[model samples]
Target: MKLLHYTYRKLSLLLLLLMAAWGVLFYYAIIDEVMDETDDTLENYSEILINNALMDPSVLETEGTLMSFYKFRPISEEEAEDYDEKYYDSTVYIESEDEDEPVRVLKTVFRMPDGQYYELELMISILERDDMVEAILWYLGALFLLFLICTSIGTRLILQSVFRPLQRLLDWLQQIQPGKELPVLDNPTKIREFQQLGEAAVDMGNRSYKAYEEQKQFIENASHELQTPLAIVRGKVELLAENESMTEQQLKELDEIYATLGRAVRLNKSLLLLSRIENGQYTETEDVSVDEVLDELLPDLMDIYEGKKIHLVRIKGEEPFVIRCNLSLTQILVSNLVKNSLVHNHAGGELYIETTSSSLIIKNSGEHPLDGEKLFRRFYRSIDGKKDSTGLGLAIARSIAISASLSLTYKWQEGMHLFLLVKESEKKS
Candidate 1:
C-alpha cells in the first residue's frame, strides 16, 4: 500500500471507534432525559390523584379505568404505616385490547378518611418512547457511516497534496543513472523537512558525479600511460628471443617471458575497456542485433576452435533479438560471451546459442558448476580455466550490459554453463 492509503486507514479506524462511542453515549443521554420527564409527569398526576382522594374518596373507585390506567386496593393500618412509594417498568393486560402493553408503573400506600388504609397504583404507556429511541439509533449509525466516508476521501486528497513533493523527489531519484549528470530538481514545497531532503539529495549527487569523473579520468590516463611501456617491453623480449648465441634454456625462458607480457597486455586492455564501459564513454548508439554479431564473429571463432570439435547449436527465433546500445560495445559484449564459451569448453564439448525477440541465451558444456557469484568479477578464473585466459571477458561483458540497461546473469544446469542477456524493459514486461 502507498503511504497515503496506509495512514488514512489508521485515521479512519480511530474516527470510527470514537464516533461509535460518542453516539452510544449521546443516545443513552437522550433516553435518560426522556425517562426523567416521564417520571415527572407520573409524579404530578399521582399528586393530583392523592389530593382528590383525600377531598372526595369516590374518585379512587371510579378513576381506575382512565386512559392512563390506575387501581386502588384497601390495606390494613399496619401495612399503610410501613408502605413506601415505588416506580418500575411492567406490562398490563387491557380487556378491551386483548393484549398486554408496556407501561411505566408507580405504586404507593395512602391513608383515607376514618383512618382507613388504601394502596394506589398508577401506569402510563411508553411504546412511543421505545420507537423514538430505535429511530435515533438508526439515524446515528447512518450519520456516522456517511461522515466516515467523507472524512476518508478528504484525508486521501489532503495526504496526496501534502506528499506531492516526496513523490516527485522519488521520481527524480529514479531518473538518475550512474555516471550521468543529475537532472534539475524542481520540487518546491513549504515543508522544511522535504526541502532539506531535496537539498541533501542534490548536494550528494553533485559530490558523487565529481568523484566519478575524477576516477574515470585517472583510469583512462593510467591505462594509456602504461600501454607504451608495456609495448616497448614486449618488443625488447621479442628481440632478446632472436639471439642466435643464446642457449636452448635461455630461449625457453624468453618465450615464457613473452607469453607473460602478452597476458599482461591483454589484462590491461580488458581493464581499459571495462573502465570505459562503466564510465559511459561510448555514448553513441544504434539498434544492434545479438544474432547478427554472433554470425559475424562465429566463422573465425569456429575455425580457431575446430581442434576441439565442439558441436554448435544455434536456435534463432523468427524475429531477431535487437537492442539499442553502442554498436562497438555490443559487438565486444557478444564476442566476449561467445569466446568464453569456446575457450572454456572441453574437447568434443557442445555450444548452444539461442536468440529470441527479447533475449539471448548461450550455454556451453561443462563438468561442474562455475561460481555464478564470482564469475562476473574482474580476473575471476576457474580452477580449470586456460592458462592464457585473461579472465576479464565476462566482467567486461557485464559492464557493457549494465551500461546499456541490460541484464547479464549466469547459471549452471545439466552439465552446462548458461549465460542469459536481456533488456531491462523486456524483463519488466
Candidate 2:
C-alpha cells in the first residue's frame, strides 16, 4: 500500500477509537442520571404508601379476601404461613413484626382517632426499577450502534478529502522511469508535508537521472579507450615474436611481457562485462532451469580443473528448479561462484555443489578465511597482496546475481566456505 493510504487508514482508526470512547462515556452519564431520578421517585412513593398504611392498616387487610397495596389479593389465611417463604416475581414483600426477615419493610407509626392499635405493612414493586434500567440499556446500545455507523461514514468522507492529493502524487511517482524527467507536480495539496515531498521527489529524480547518464557515458568511453591500448599491445607482441635475431633472455622476457599483457586483456574484458551488466543492456529474460545451465558449464569447469587434485562433487536434486532470468548472466553468476570456490580451495580440497527448492549452494574447504562483507567489494582480498587473484570474482558474481534478480550470499560453516545462490522468487517469501 502507498504511504498516504496507510496514513488515512490509521487516522480513521484513531477517530473510530475516540468516538467509541466518547459514546461509552455519554451512555454511562445518561444512565446514571436516569437511575438517580428513578431512585428519588421510588423513595417518595414508598414514603406516601407507608404514611397511608400507618393511618389505617385496613388498606392492607380485606374482609372477604385480604388485599395488599394496589388492590392485589393477598394469599389466603391458610396459605399465609407458606406465603412468608414464597415470593412473587413482580412484587417485594414486607412484614411488621419480628423484623428479622430478609424482605424490605417501610415502617411508620400513626395513632388512630380512637386510640386503637394497628400495624401498617407495605411492599414495593422492584420490577419497575428493573424495567427502567433495561429500557435505558436498550436505548444506549441502539445509540452506540448508530454512533459507530455515523463515525465510519464520517471517517471515510474526511479521509477521502485529506488523501486525494496524496493518491495523485503516488500515481505520478509510479509513472516516473529512469533516464526520464519527472512529471510536473500540479496537485494543490492542502497538506504542507505532501507539497514538500513532491518538490523533493522532483529534485531527486532529476539529480539521479543526470548521474546515471554521466556514469553510463564514462563506462562506454573507458571501455573503448582500454580496447585501443589493448590492440596496440597485442600488435607490438606479435611484431616482437616475429623477430628472429633476439637473444634467449630477450625471448623469455618478451614471452613474460606477452603473458602479462594477456592477463591485462582478460581483466579488461571482465570489466567490460561488468559494465554491460550494470548498464542493463541484457534485457532479454526466459524461464531457465538452474540445473541445465550448470550441466552445460560442467565441461568448461572440468577443463579448468583437469590437473588440480580438487574433487568435484555434484549432488543432483529431485525437483526441477526454474526461474525467469537472463540465461547468459545466470550462467556467468553460477560459474563465477563455483570458480571462485575452486580457486580459493586448499590443495586436494573437495568442491561440493547442490541445489535446494529455491537455491544452489557451493561449498569448499579453503586455506584462506574470508570476510564475507568485503568479499563482494571491487578489488578487495583477505590475503596479503596476492596479485595472482583479480579479487573481482565475487564482485562479478554479485553483479550478475543482481542483474538476474537473484541474491548471492556467502557464509562460513564448519571450516568450509558456503556460497548460496537464492533465486528471486525465493526472496519474495
Candidate 3:
C-alpha cells in the first residue's frame, strides 16, 4: 500500500475507537444526569406534600394523580422511628397510554398533628426525560458521522498535497541511466526530512555519474596504451622469425614467443570489447531477428571450423524471434555463443539452434558438462581446457544479453550444453 493510504487507515481506526469511547462515556453521563434531575424533582414534590399534610391532615385523604402521585398510610411508632427518606425508580401502569411508564419514587416517614406516624410516597413521571435522551443520542450519532466524513476527505487531500514532492523525486529517479548525465531535481519540499532525503539522493546521483565517467575513461586509455606495445612486439617477433641465423631450437622458441604474443593480443582485444559493451558504447538499437543473425553467422562459422565435421541443426518457430538491441552487439553476442559451441564440440558432433518468438536456445553436444556457476565468469576455462580459448566469450555474451534486457542462462541436459537467451519479460513471466 501507499504510505499515505496506510497512515490514513490507521488514523481512521484510531478516530473510530476514540469516538466510540466518548460516545459510551457521554451516553452514561447524560442518562445519570437525567435520572438525578428526576429524583430531585420527586424530592421537591415530597417536601411540598409533607408540608401540606402537616398544615391540614385532611389533605392526605385525596388520591394520587398522573403527573405527580402520592400515598399516605398509617404506621406504628416503632416503624416510623426506623423509617428514613429514600428514593428509587419504579414502573407504573398509565391508563391514558395503556403501557408501563417509568417514574422516580420517594418514600419518607412523618408524624401528623395527632402524634400518629404515617408513611408517605411521592412519584414523578420520567417519560419525557427518556425521550430527551433518545433525541440526544440521535443528534450525537448524526454529528459523529458528519465529523468522520469531513475528517476522511480533509486528511486525504492534505496527505496528497504533502507527499507531492516525494512523488516528483521518484519520477526524477526513474529517468536516471548508467551512461546518461544526472537529471536536475526540481522538486522543492518544505518538510525538513523530505528536503534532506532529496538532497541526499541528488548527491548520490552526482557521485555515481562521476564514478562512471572515470571508469569509462580509464578503460579506453588502458586499451589504447596496451595495444601499441603489443602490436610492436608481434611485428618484431615476426621479423626475427624471418632471419636465417636462427637455429632450430631458437626458431621453435621464437615460434612459441610469437604464439604467446598473438594470444596476448587477442586477450587484450576481447577485454576491450567487453569493457565497451559494459560502458554502453554500443547504444544504437533496432529490432533485430535472431534467426537472421544465425543465418549470417552460421555459414562463416562452419567454414572456419569445417575441419571439426560438426553437423548443424536449426529449429525455427513459425513466428520470428525478434528483440530490440544494438545490432552490432546482437551480432557479437550470437557470434560468441556460436563460436564457443563450435570450439568446444568434438569431431562429428552436433550443434543445435532453436529460435522462437520469445527465446533463442543453442545446444551443442559435448563430452562433459561445464560448470554452470563459473561458465560466465571472465577467464573461466573447462577442466579439459583448450589452449587457444580465451574463456571470455560466454562472459561477454552474458553481459550483452543483460545490457539489452535479456536473460542468458546455461544448463547441461541430456549430454548437451544448452545456452538459453530469452527476453527479460518472458523470463519473468
lDDT by candidate, in order shown: 0.89, 0.71, 0.90
lDDT for each residue of candidate 1 in 59-170, tens digit (9 for 90 to 100) = 8786555358887888998888788898888887877889877788888888876788888888888765568778987998899889988988888989999999999999
Lowest lDDT block of 10, candidate 3 = 124-133
Model 2, 1-429: lDDT tens digits are 865568657866786677667766876786567556544544565456546655766754532111224332333434443343212223333364433222222332334455443333433333344465578667866876687678667866787888788788788889876556667778888699988987888788889889878887887798789889988988898798889988789988988888777778778778878877776767789988888888888778867876777888998788756767788887887788878777777678888999866789899986566788898998887774346666777888898888777888888888888998887767788
> Taking the tens digit of each residue's C-alpha lDDT, what string does model 3 give over 1-429?
988999899989998889888987888898898888888787777778889999988878976788788899999999988887898889899888899888888899888889999888888877655686688779888988999899999999999999999989999999998889988899877899889999999999999999999998998899899999999998898898899998999989999998898888889889989988888888889999989999998999999999999999999999989999999899999999999899889999999999999999999998888889999999999987789788899999999998899999999999999999999999889
Q: Report the candidate with higher lDDT, 1 versus 2.
A: 1
- Scored by TM-score, the top model is 1
User: Roughly what TM-score does model 2 have, to 2 decimal places?
Assistant: 0.65
CA deviation > 4 Å runs, candidate 1: 62-67, 74-87, 92-101, 108-120, 127-134, 175-177, 243-257
TM-score of each: 0.84, 0.65, 0.77
Rank order (by TM-score, best first):
1, 3, 2
User: Pairs clashing in candidate 2?
Assistant: none
Q: Tell me how many clashing residue pairs each candidate has.
A: 0, 0, 0
